[model samples]
Target chain A: MSRVRVHNFSVSLDGYGTGEGQSMEAPFGHAGERLHSWFFETRTFHQMQGRPGGGTGADDALASAWGPGIGAEIMGRNKFGPQRGPWQDEEWKGWWGPDPVFRTPVFVLTHHPRPSVEMAGGTTFHFVDATPQEVLRMAREAAGDRDVRIGGGPSTIRQFLAADLIDHLHVVLVPIVLGRGERLWDGLEELEARFPSVESVTTPSGVTHLTFARP
Target chain B: MSRVRVHNFSVSLDGYGTGEGQSMEAPFGHAGERLHSWFFETRTFHQMQGRPGGGTGADDALASAWGPGIGAEIMGRNKFGPQRGPWQDEEWKGWWGPDPVFRTPVFVLTHHPRPSVEMAGGTTFHFVDATPQEVLRMAREAAGDRDVRIGGGPSTIRQFLAADLIDHLHVVLVPIVLGRGERLWDGLEELEARFPSVESVTTPSGVTHLTFARP
Candidate 1:
């Protein structure tokens, strides 16, 4: 069955999915690339950048799962770009150049909706203003036989989690304490009960990979 | 050299040390015993209650290190009891009953300073309003040749961590999410940089033990 999975979602030790002060320059804010440094070092991530010979250990194994089996993605507006409020102009395609990594029917949740734009590598950006459930219904339809991925900016993930829609979640606990940022676990009371099968594995990079899956 | 260490500090997957709504009845608030259920199963914790024959594995080994080689403990006012603000009366010794743990000088950080109350088993509760450095100075002096422990209620630990006083920290990541509570990692920006030697171990109880030691 197709599932709603969150893969390679990195959070600080303090449960912050991203750091504060997210801008066009600093997409992850002061957290910068520290939260995703582990992923950057992985062989899978290197392959995405058209680079060869990266670490092929546990980190790569998990990083490699991001694209496979994912038909569509539901991402917050922040993940698409740092442009908040109404779009200043449609010129801001995304943080990624013409060829974005998603390469799927990516639904961007925003208050100000816009027309869908198709990018290179089979990636299409669809803007919608709706609740998580409503957007998820659309994403599920777009996903069809494949699974829908909840690409997050913390608040987005929290909403889906609060709605009990996520079936599989892969969270990487980065060693750094972000101190102040958008926290992902807010209002997720008694989260352990929802996911019975939880496993943790520590890679050589000193980050713990926690996977929570519903039975 | 005597060290300042934190052992067996339990936190939820969301990085909450304890849940919200802490009162006299709920020492750990709504978190209850869920955060510490793993420790309770350990032989060291069972032995604390005068019980016997508990598991002697990794969890037990880590739990057993709570007391030995520690001469003094510096804890936040919340950890002692749920009585916030000024001391209503000097009668509340602690929640640990007559035979409380920590057979040494235990300094409780509180604005309303009360006279020292010596409890059973050589545990002396000394209330004082001082900074982490000031309290640590007194604890180190009282400890003599032994080490001091920075006992916590999240906020207290964050203070010590901000001051860069703690040399060793052992944080257990419980798989639960309290949603609302006092977080331990607040204001501790880029904490991983301070602790160079970090390690993680997953036990049978489905909790990952993360140890960070300053070089």
Candidate 2:
């Protein structure tokens, strides 16, 4: 069976996956670029932007883990764009510009579904109103032999985690204290039991890579 | 001025300082020594329990930092014992038995104040119902020229942190998730500004020692 994996998901010291009051101007709200600065400086992120030259340290190695083996991606609408509750503008082609980095079928969860948008690169956004199980089924079908990735805005990942749909989880624990924001581990108490084997490594950049997996 | 400090404070990956259902039998509740396992293996903790021979690594070095600091210690009532609402037993001389670990004046915050208890060692338990600021003043006075330590039960540390009384904070980030319990970070949003300088080092034991100091 193909695995359901989450990779390089960053969170603050206080457990906030993303800062509060997210908007178009500040998608991470009060958090700014603090949550993802590690990824942004990495070669993996630079490569994603189709750029050259980036950090070649432990951080880059962990950040690079996000791409491989991921076939299809399941994301919340918030990650697709800042618009909430019945899309404000049809022209909003996501924060990733005309050519999104996701070079696969992206299943976005939304209350008000819209027609699919085929972007440059191999990316195609499919907005759908479906449960985590239903969406996972669709993503798994689309993923084929490769693994399905759970792209997060926190809530989507929490729902899938609660449903026990995830097989491998990779979280980057950033040292900065966000104080207030959307938490990744709110309702999932004793979440370690689901994935018995866990490993952690902290890089020189002061971020710890926590990987939880089932054997 | 006597500096206020907290050291070796253990918190889970999800930010829980302690676990739920705390009692006399289970001091750390369902967490069950999981949070303090790093400390337990450290030579500092072994020396605290009057034992010898523990891991002589980075964890031990950081654990040893809890001592040496300065004088008096202020803590929440919960850290003293499990009993609540005006205390259950007068015979209960705290969890430390006859001779407590804290050799300095220990001020315990409680609603119902009681007469001070002089233990076998130099340790003295002073129960007072004072605000964080007021307690800090008292602790500073008791500490004299030496620094004052802010012992925690999460809430105690949070209170001191809110009052901007702590000069040094050392938090041990344990790689476990306790879904419920008192959180140390709660309302301390943008707390990073208070401490201008911060440093972190991950030990071989997989625990990160995060130090925030006003430099």
Candidate 3:
């Protein structure tokens, strides 16, 4: 059966998934950008950017799994950008340019309203204003039997995990610490206890990749 | 021998360590808060804050490594908070408040000059205007055979890695793609290829932990 999953999220040593104060200028934050250095140098990343003769290996394999054939994505408005206090307008597509990195249809959870954004790739952005189950249903329809990925910012992932909607989760561990910032998994002990098994691999770049599944 | 190390700096899957525009209110930026969620709940973090009974097993062990060290600490001026050209005075301490996180003598790498900020604890923030090697020499003196840690933003760690000054590195990968922003390992293919040995572990919160060492 197709499942909903959260894949390849990178985090810091201090438990901060990111650093404080992100903006279009600095994206991750001052100290947060060091998280995904492993993936950037991968051959897959180079290939995606249309660069020639990049790489192919375990790192490339991991990068290739990042995107491709994933029918749909679900996330919160915060993941889209830093806008708060009601949707200002659709002018802010995202930090990404006209076309986002994801080529699949994306569902963003928000209390506000916005139209769908069609990018150069096969990707489209859809705004969902409902409960986790409702969004999951919509994403499943959009995804068919392929699989639905819960692309994140934290709150969105937490809500789905809280609802037991995710089937598999792949977390990539980057080594660093932000002394302060928002946290992922701050209080999810009850939810995590339900997972039955996990698989792990470590990248040469110091990224420990983990895949957790529930029976 | 006590070696210098850089561990667990989390960046967004997007390439940004921290997000763009940094401000006092939204220090990490937009959804960047999701990046470091793991640390806030770690026992290591709580203990640093003088709170008791607030960490998970793996989380506590990692958090404990963050503070209460007699060794010297290193940081970029930006971590001392925002910078405007060179240092005009010695008054600016840090964003961490009176007690500050580091209780030992700290070194701030800057192109400017300023006197050290001595705190109640053994902490004293000193601004250094020299190469990393020079800073290392002074830090070793202050550390006195204890370990020296590279408290960083991406640039600082990259410099250390490029110079091969770090002997040990740890990474914690959370899952998320910033899709835009600064990159941690923007140009680190050679460094990654050199440090090939790696080890991994995972926590209940879906964070994959990794440690890399250069023998």
Candidate 4:
């Protein structure tokens, strides 16, 4: 079955997905790279950098799981870049270079929609000012037989979680206190009840991979 | 030199140390036994019940670690009982019958200080309206050479954390989402900076024991 999954979504011990004061230079704001330090040590992350020789550990194993079975992704506008409100001009393509990490059609949720931008490689950014359901429908269509992924910046994932749209959620619980930032678990109290199957694996790198999947 | 330590402090994935709507029936509020189910499976909890055998896993080892090398305990009024504001009467000794978990002296943090009550076994309850520092002084006196444990109910832990009174913190991260409850990490931003050392171990019971210690 084609399931909607969220993979390798990192959060601090305090539950903040990203830190305060996010900007172009700091996509994750004050959180810096602390939330994703574990990811950086993974082979998948090394491969993303077009480099080699990264840690082949439990973290790498869990992190690399995101690529398989995923066909398309849906991310918030902020995830595409640090730009907010009306697209300041079409100058900013995205945080990714010519070729992005996701080699599939990606739907960018925004209040103010813009023309679709096709980049190098298989990645193409489609802007949509739609609800989680509508965006998911478009992503699922683009996904075809494969599964759709909710590539988050916290709020986007929360919307899907609140709507009970996600089938598999892989949260990488990083051991840090971000203090202030976007919280992933707000409003959706007892979201675990929706996903009966829960599992946790703490790697030696000090990150706990917590997975909640619907049976 | 004796240190102020906190051990076996269980919290939901959403950072709630205790659940909402706490009463005599539901001490952990709506969270109920979901948070402490891992503890029940531990050998320590079994020993407390005078049972012979229990799961001798990482959960058991970590849960049992709470008692050792500790003397006097300082807990929030809520952790002791559900009674709030001024005490109705001294009839409520505690949730534990004759002998409570803490064999050492236990100090209850409250605005309304009451006369000390000595119970069966070595456990003694002393109600104090003093600040964290003042209480620490009294607890140190009571503890003598042994360490002092910061027994918590989220708000009390937060108060001690805010005051930088806790030296070592061992938090049992239970895999549950208590949407609304007392948040332990609130206002204590970047607390990991104070504790230079951090380690995590996830048990098969889907609980992660996160320990933060000072260098």
Q: Which candidate's lDDT is highest?
A: 4
List, residue by residue over B1-215, the lDDT tens digit for candidate 4: 79999988999888999898999999999999988998888789988877788999888887888888998999999999999899997889889888887899999999988999999889999999999999999999999999999989899999999999888999999888889889999898888888889999988888999999984
Which residues of candidate 1, in runs, are more than 4 Å off?
A: B85-91
Tell me the tens digit of each residue's lDDT in model 1 across B1-215. 68999999999877889888889888888888999999999999888888888889999998899889999999999999888887786788888888888889999999999889988889998889999989999999999999999999899998998899999999999877888788888777878788878888778787888999985
- Candidates 1 and 4 compared: the better one by DockQ is 4
Candidate 4 lDDT by residue in tens digits, A22-42: 898899999999999889988
Q: Which ten residues in a row have the lowest lDDT in candidate 4 chain A?
A: A82-91
For each candidate in turn, the TM-score is 0.93, 0.97, 0.54, 0.98
lDDT (10s digit) by residue, model 3, range A81-140:
877768776788876677677788899888886788888777788876899999888988
lDDT of 2 by residue, A1-215 (tens): 99999999999899999998988899999899998998899998898888999999999987888888989999998888888898779898888988899999999999989899999899999999999999999998998999999999898999999998999999998888798888899888878888887888888787888889995
For model 1, the chain A TM-score is 0.97
Alpha-carbon lDDT, every model: 0.89, 0.89, 0.70, 0.91
Give the local distance difference test score of model 2: 0.89
Assess chain B of each prediction and give its TM-score: 0.97, 0.98, 0.89, 0.97
- Of the pair 2 and 3, which is ahead by DockQ? 2
Taking the tens digit of each residue's C-alpha lDDT, what string does model 1 give over A78-129? 9988887878988988887888888899999999999999999989999999
TM-score of 2: 0.97
Best by DockQ: 4
Where model 4 places Cα greater than 4 Å from the true spot, the runs are: none
By TM-score, rank the candidates, best first: 4, 2, 1, 3
Interface RMSD for all numbered candidates: 1.3, 1.4, 10.4, 0.8
